[model samples]
Target chain A: MSRRAQENLVALVVLGVFIVAIVMAFDYGQRARMVPLPIALIGVVLTLWQLVWQNIRPADELNIDLLEVLTRREGEAVARNVSSNFDEQSAHQKRQAAGRESVACGMVLLLLGLVWVIGLLPGVFLFMLGYFLLSDHYSLPRALSYSLGLVVALYLLFVQGLGIALYHGWLEEWIRNL
Target chain B: MIDAIVAGLAALMTPQAMVFMFIGVIYGLVIGILPGLGGVVAMALLLPFTHGFEVAATLALLLGAHIATIWGSSVTGILFNVPGAAKSLTSCFDGYPMTKQGQATRALGASATGALLGGILGAIFLAVSIPLVRPIMLALGPSEYLMMALWGLTIIATFSEGSLMKGLIASVLGILIAFIGMDPVTATPRYTFDILYLMEGISFPVAMIGLFAVAEMMKLYVKGGSIVDRQMTEERSTVWQGVRDAFVHRWLIVRSSLLGVWIGVLPGVGATVGGLAAYAQAVQTSKTPERFGKGAVEGVIAPDATVGANEGGGLMPTLAFGIPGGEGMAILLVAFIGLGVVPGPDMLTKNLDLVFSMVWIIVIANIFVTIIGLGVAPYLARLPALHANLMVPAVLAVCFVGAYATRGQIEDVAMAVAFGILGYLMDKYHYSRANLVIGMVLAIMIERNLHLSLTLYGSDFLLERPVAAAMLAFIIVTTALPFVRRWWKRRKLAAAGGRA
Candidate 1:
């Protein structure tokens, strides 16, 4: 698939899954009912709109060029990118009319769920430190120092200064209270 | 007034209050200098610590810290072209340009003094607005608040810079995030999906830090960059010229301070709207309007004044009605409740002393902040130019600590990290993150207020209420005004072209 179709397909798949989850959440009493009612309706509408718009709408006529928009902020850069991409823009529009599968925001939610699994401190410390080192923000020595410093500061501020209990997650909570 | 001043000074002069005020001011400046975090995050983080302090002492810390951040944010925006907060984004327009022009010292000085003057005048407006607050609170109900929020959102049209649809999309996304927790009216979990931690909803500070701070950090990493520009032009001007410019733009100070106070008093508009509205007004009123984005001193002064004034204005509703104006004020409201001060009209009559004490804190904090802010102007202006190596680790550590401090939840830290990556992507992609952040901040208030209005008055909420009707009309006008101005300018340009 071309890039636009690819992007829209991703959005639609996510919205489609959300519609289902929202439908399921309709049973969470009156409160949960509020969410699914509007969310499902909106999700359905957005998905259908995405699907219909992409099928009928000619891409070249559209003002927004997503790739060009992403690559630059200035108007001239946009114009330059658009001009350079113009010849292939028509040819790239030809794409597979078959087999497509889409996923949900399940990955995002899974990330959150795993966050709870690891507990707050270790999970966050590792995530931030790992992201830093992996992303090449710092060398190993620097990343370790930064992460360790952040943990110490956080401990001092929250645990020592404020005296609040930290989130231990369900497993940690079970282990500690037991 | 003199007697009130003396009494206020006496009440504020304690060693503890003085020390706390100093600490809060310094802390606020540093926190503001850090990209992503703003005044609200600083206050929220400090709130959990102020639990045991006396009212005066607490105000010393909270009030001082809040005032000091206005300058702190502007300094970064001017020196680095990277705003410390969203409101300071406007400062980047002229500030960075001036920095490029080798007028960094003048620009830094101007922003600092503007903050000082703007803050003092804003405080004055706050005190003057006090007597009216009681009746104002009484006249306001949920319906009025809902209308007020609608009016607040109209500002997005004004702030969209150009594209209203993109801004609207950004705002809708914000509202979506705000709706993530339980329904305010039905107490329903709107989008929580049974996660227990989602019960209280995403802490506004956590989301804000994640959206801005974390995003900035991620962008720095992805781009392989430093936080500050770290370039030097010959420092050609004395700091006092900027100081004189502050006094020179005294009227703008008063005007923007009033704008800030007016927005602040409304009890939900907060500094984000206040700053943008003030900048918009400053640009509208400037004689040499073309100078605005190229380092107009008044442009710097206007937002600073509004930021100060906003604090005082925010205190009005927060103190009078026990209704917080913004996230920062909400924390302040909680502090008041913990101290056994029942807000509303009762605060005016019974706790008049305390009310005046807060007003005094505003004046004293601004004065202290100004002195400290001005003293450090020349040096702090150089932070953005720091080597990326040192800046990256220190800032990342501080930001993580900030995220963790909110709710004492590690998930918040992860959220910050994830959002940091998102923020960097958004910045790279040319989507206005400020609009997105504002949408997030205002979304909860909008959703809650809308839910309350819908629940209370049914879906025909505005149809029955006069204030709502009037506000709706006002929103129509304000929303159209920006577009009308833009269209008119376009037409005028076309007409000029045709004539040529």
Candidate 2:
């Protein structure tokens, strides 16, 4: 997708969220929805405006600031010197970046899943060790050492020092029951 | 007052109080460096240990930990993009960028020193303002508070970056998200989706951990580099440079500290709001406003100073009116009760010496934190220079674990991950996460206060309240000034071009 298309898609998603919120807000009491309803309506209007404005403008001009638009005359410089820090990349590089982002996202989900299934300590330990090993960032022994040291530190700080009851995971619960 | 001040210093001169203060500062710093834990947690954890200790020692431990956490949280926000707590979120805006430029030690030094100066100044202000607090507190109403929240929202323009529309939308979305919990006015759950956990609303710290910390790690994984470039790290600034930066920006520090103290004096207004407000004021007042959110040292200094001074401001209501300023102050109130220190008008006349002791603790503890912060800043600055592969997992683990640790809920971990994805997408697109956080911070305050203002004085509340009316006018002028200035500059340039 083009950058403009991606921006439009996100804007549309935001618009949809506001619309859904406004609809759901009506189900509440008058006092309950008083603040939320107006806020959501404002959100919808702002987002819809963003969607329309981004789509209508040329790709280069799409990065225009609203404040500048309000302040400047017609055909005046609308693009503020506000850098968004986005760099231009080739199609191949974009694809490569997208792939890396997907992997990163997947790793985050995998860690989350691991934590959910096997509790925080074991989950974090496994995730860290796997990441260290798979990324070729550390030797196996070093990875093991780092992971163990972190888990031990977590245990001492949270479990012992603070007296927090960490989640023992569904797998641990099942195994213990069996 | 002089006698009480001397008595306060003499009381804290005890070896037990000094030792406790040291231990509390260290513990607070450690907890503050952790992603989810903040001063409240540090103080709450030490509550049980407060028993049977001397009054000075007990207050030292509790208040010292609270003071230390302000700098502790800024350390992470500066070095990593991960804020230790919501109050430090503004620090991450410029502090992390400074880190990326390998100026992490400088950022840390400025943050610590800003806090130290703010703390001392706030302590002095607290002592001076004690006699004048009650009428000031009574003079402001819910309408004034609502205006203050609106004033906070007006600064969304500062963080809008390139797109005010997108920034407003992000802030609106954040406000909507804050409405997910049970409504304070009507007791009706607004957007809970019937989930039991949602009734309590989203945990601010958990969402913050996911938004900044987890999101940054994901970005690191994709970008394939350390947070600070190796080339940049070689030319890193010294800690003294940062300390000097804080002093050079002394006027900004004083202004931000006063703002912090004022916000602290207001009941239920938190350091989170104070920090963000300070940042907003910094941006608004700066001649080169464009340097903010991109490694302006003032951006780092303003918020840290505000947060540091906030502790002293927060104590006023807690000590004077038996009303806690914020959650940390609430916990301190609990400790005060245990220590047999009554908080009311009597507290002023009877326990004036005790109040002075707490003030002395704030000043002394801040000095200790700054000393320790400067000592370790060089080593802490090197953490970001580690390879992305090592940092990604290490930070993510801490973030997820910290998210769970926040409320001891597994669901908060899931919430953190979800927000992480949202944060990454928001950053990828041009949404202002800072605006969103500010929106979230002020939403409940605005909503609750608006309801109260409406109920108490009806719709014409602003007209009825002179202070609120003035604040509204101030908000309008400040919010419009930048656009007006820009337009005037552009017109002048256009005229110059025609002549040329």
Candidate 3:
């Protein structure tokens, strides 16, 4: 998607959230919804303004500054400068960045899933091992050593030292019940 | 007063208290450096062990660690753009930029000195303000507090450098997010949607960990570099330069410290607001306001000073009226009761010396933290130079575990991840995450106080309360001053161009 499209998508998502919130506010009593209702309404208005403004303006002119708007400053020049700085990257580079961002997001989700299924210590250890190996930044032996040593240290600090009962994971609990 | 001061010093001078103070400072520093663990956690963890210690020793340990964490949390925020606690969030604005500019040591130094000076000033204020504080506290009602929270909202303008509309929307979203759980005023769940965990509301630290830390790691992975550029790994400024910056901006430090103390004195207005307010004041007062949020030393100095002095301000109400100033002070009050210290007016009259001991501990603890902070700053400054491959996974691991450690709920980890994705998107867009956090911090305070003011004095509360009305006027003036100045400047330029 184009940068403008992405920006519009985010604005639309925000607008949706505010609309949903305002709709849900009706379910609450007067006191409960008083603050949230007004705030959500403001959000909806502001986001709609943003969506409309961004669509009408050129992509380069979309960097609207509240101060500039209030002061009626030379906003076009400022917006162009700001947008140009971010837009300096080539389309190819932007695509590459998007790919990397996707991978990063996937890795985070994978780590979260691992932690949920296998618990914190073991999950973190496995995630680190997998990341270190895949990233090709460390030797196999070094990755193993670093992962083991760090996990052991975490175990000592959180479990032994602090005496926190870490979540022992769904797998551990389920197996124990069986 | 002189006798009590001397007695307080004498009490704190004991070997037991001194040793415990040192240990507590160190422990607090460690906990503060870790993501999601703050002074409250540090003190809460030590609470179980507080049974057998001397009163002086126990207070020193609790208060000392709390004091040290103020600077400890700033270390992470400064170096990595990952604030260890919400209060330290302000530090990440300029501190991380300075780190990228190879001035991490200097930033660390300034932060330490600012914190040290703020702590000392706060301690002095606590000693002097004890007797005079009651009337001041009584004069300010919920209307005034609501005005203060509104004053904090004005800071959203400062963060709205890119897109004011987006900043406002982000802040509104943040306020809405704060309302997700049960409403305190009416005993009704506002937006839980049948989730049991949502009944308690989102944990601030957990949200913060995901927003800044986890999001930062993801950014690092995408960028394929360490936090600091390889070319900028060499230190550009010394720790002395940072310390000197703090002293050179002594007036700013003093103002920020006073702000911190005032915010601290106000019940429910924690250091989070104090730090942001100080930053707002700094930016507002700066001649070159554009330099802020782009590695301005004043930006680093103001927040640290405010947070440093906040503890001292926080202790006043907790000791005198038994009303805790913030969460950390609330924990301290629990420890106070455990140690047989009854906090009330008698605490001022009968236990004046003990109060002085706590003051003395703040002074001593700040000195120790500054010394240690300055010593390790050069080494700590090198952390941002690590490869992204090593740093990303490690930091993410810590962040995930820290999120879980925050409330010991597995659901918190999920919340952290969700916020992380949102944060990444927000950053990619022009939205200000700082404004959102500020909104979250002040939303409850504003709502609760508004409700109380309405109940107590009706809708015309602001008009009825002269002080709150004046404060409202002040907030309007301060909020408008920058825009007015900018407009005047632009008008002059336009006229000059036409004349030329």
Candidate 4:
């Protein structure tokens, strides 16, 4: 997606949240609805204003220097031209980042699932080892050692020192029951 | 006052008390350096151990750790652009910028020294103003707190350096998120969507870890460069230079510390507001206000100073009126009740010695933390130079674990990851995560106070409450001054150009 489209989409998400808040407020008691209703109403207005403004303004004029008026400092010209939506990167770089981000998000979700199924310590150990190896940043043996050391340190600090109860996980519970 | 001070010093001088204080200071620093583990958690963990200890020793352990964490929280903010706690968010404005410029040592030093001075000054202020603080505290009500919260919201203007409209929209969204859980006043859940975990609300620390630490790692992972650009420039400033920077900005430290103490004194305003308010004040009052949020040393110093002094201010409500000023104080109040300490107007008289003991701990703990902070800063500055590959997984793992350990719920880990993605997108889109955090911080306070103010005083509350009226006026001026000044300058520029 282009920068402008992305900006509008995000604003629309925010506007949707406000609408949800307003709808939710209607379900509550009068006293409960009192604050949320008004706040959400204002939120909707502001977000709508932002969305309309983004659409109306030309892309070149989007970078409004809000701080310049506030500071009034000399020689420290606030770079008003910097666009949040458009970075100085090639299409390939942007694509590469998006791919990496997907992989990263996937890894986090995988870790969460692993924790639920196997347990925190084992899940963490496996994730670290797998991540290091998958990234091709370290050799397999090096990944194993780093993951081992991390798990040991985590066990010592959180479990032994703080005496926090770690989650036993679904796998552990099933094994125990059997 | 002299007698109280002497008694405080004598009580804290005991071998056991001293040892506990030192240990607490060290423990607090470690917790503060870690992302998402704040002073509230530190106090909660220590609350169990406070059961059998002597009152003085217990206060030393709890208060010492609490005070140290204020500066300790600044460490990651300065070094890595990741706030260890919400209170350290303001420090990241300039602190991280300084790190990128290879002045991490200097920024850390300024933070430590500022925090040290602020803590001592705040303690002294509390001691001297004890007689005058009560009536002032008693006079303020929900109306006043609501106004103070609004004042905090005004600082969003400072953080909205990119786009004002986008900043406001982002902040409103954040405030809406804060309404997710059961309302503190009416006990009605707003937007839980029937999820069981949503009943408790989104955890602030968990959101913060996602918004800052995890999102930052994602950016680093994709960008693939050391956080510190050592090739561009060598370390330009030393740890001692940072110390000198703090000393040079002595008046700024004093002013920010007083602001912090004032915020801390108010029930539930908390250090996060104090930090942001102090940063705002620093920017507003400076000759070169634009230097702020861009590695200005004053930016680092101001927030740290406020946090340091905020500890003393927090004790006012907890000790005198039985009201917890902040989350950490709420936990400490529990410990206080467990220790058989009664908090009331009578605390000013009967438990004066114990009160003084807490003050002395703040003073002594600041000194200890500053010494340790200075000693460790140079070594800590090197952390950002590590390869992103190693740093990314390690930080992400710790962040996920920390988020889970916050309430022992894996769902929170999921929430953190979700927010992490949200935070990354926000950064990419210039949607001001700082404003979002501010909105979340103030939402409950603002909503609760607004309800109480209206119900109690009706529609004409502004006319009835002079203090609230004055605060409203202050907020108006604070909000308008920037725009008004900008307009005046633009007009002058246009006129000058026409004449030329």
In model 2, where do residues sit more than 4 Å from their true spots? Answer: A72-88, B490-500
* Cα lDDT listed for each candidate: 0.64, 0.88, 0.89, 0.84
Ranking by TM-score: 3, 2, 4, 1
DockQ of each: 0.13, 0.56, 0.60, 0.48
Best prediction by TM-score: 3
In model 1, the runs with Cα more than 4 Å from the true position are: A1-178, B13-17, B30-58, B69-114, B158-164, B225-252, B272-303, B321-354, B387-390, B455-459, B496-500
Question: What does candidate 2's lDDT look like per residue over B1-500, in tens digits?
Answer: 89999999999999999999999999999999999999999999999999999999999999999999999999999988889989998888889889888788899999999999999999988899888877999899999999888888877876664567788888999999999989999999878999999999999998899888988888999988888777746636999998999999999999999998999999999999899889888887887666777789999999999999999999999998989999999999999999888899887888899989999999999999999999999999999888998889888988888999889999999999999999998877768777788888999999999999999999999888899999999988877776566667778999999999
Residue pairs in collision within model 1: A31-B188, B36-B213, B118-B305, B122-B309, B214-B420, B215-B420, B228-B384, B230-B385, B267-B325, B320-B344
Label model 2 with its docking quality class.
medium
The window of 10 residues in a row where model 2 chain A has the poorest summed lDDT is A76-85
Pick by lDDT: 1 or 3, better one: 3
Best by lDDT: 3
Worst 10 residues of 3 chain A by lDDT: A73-82
lDDT of 2 at B18: 100
Tens digits of lDDT, candidate 4, B88-170: 99888899989998899999999999999999999989899999988898899999999888888888876664676677877
Tens digits of per-residue lDDT, candidate 3, A66-173, equal 435665643222134445545777888888989999999999999999999999999999999999999899999999999998888788877786678888899999
lDDT of 1 at B217: 45
Instruction: Please provide TM-scores, in order, for all candidate models, with all chains considered together.
Output: 0.74, 0.96, 0.97, 0.94
In CAPRI terms, model 4 is classed as: acceptable
**2 or 3, greater by DockQ:** 3
Q: Comparing 1 and 4 by TM-score, which wins?
A: 4
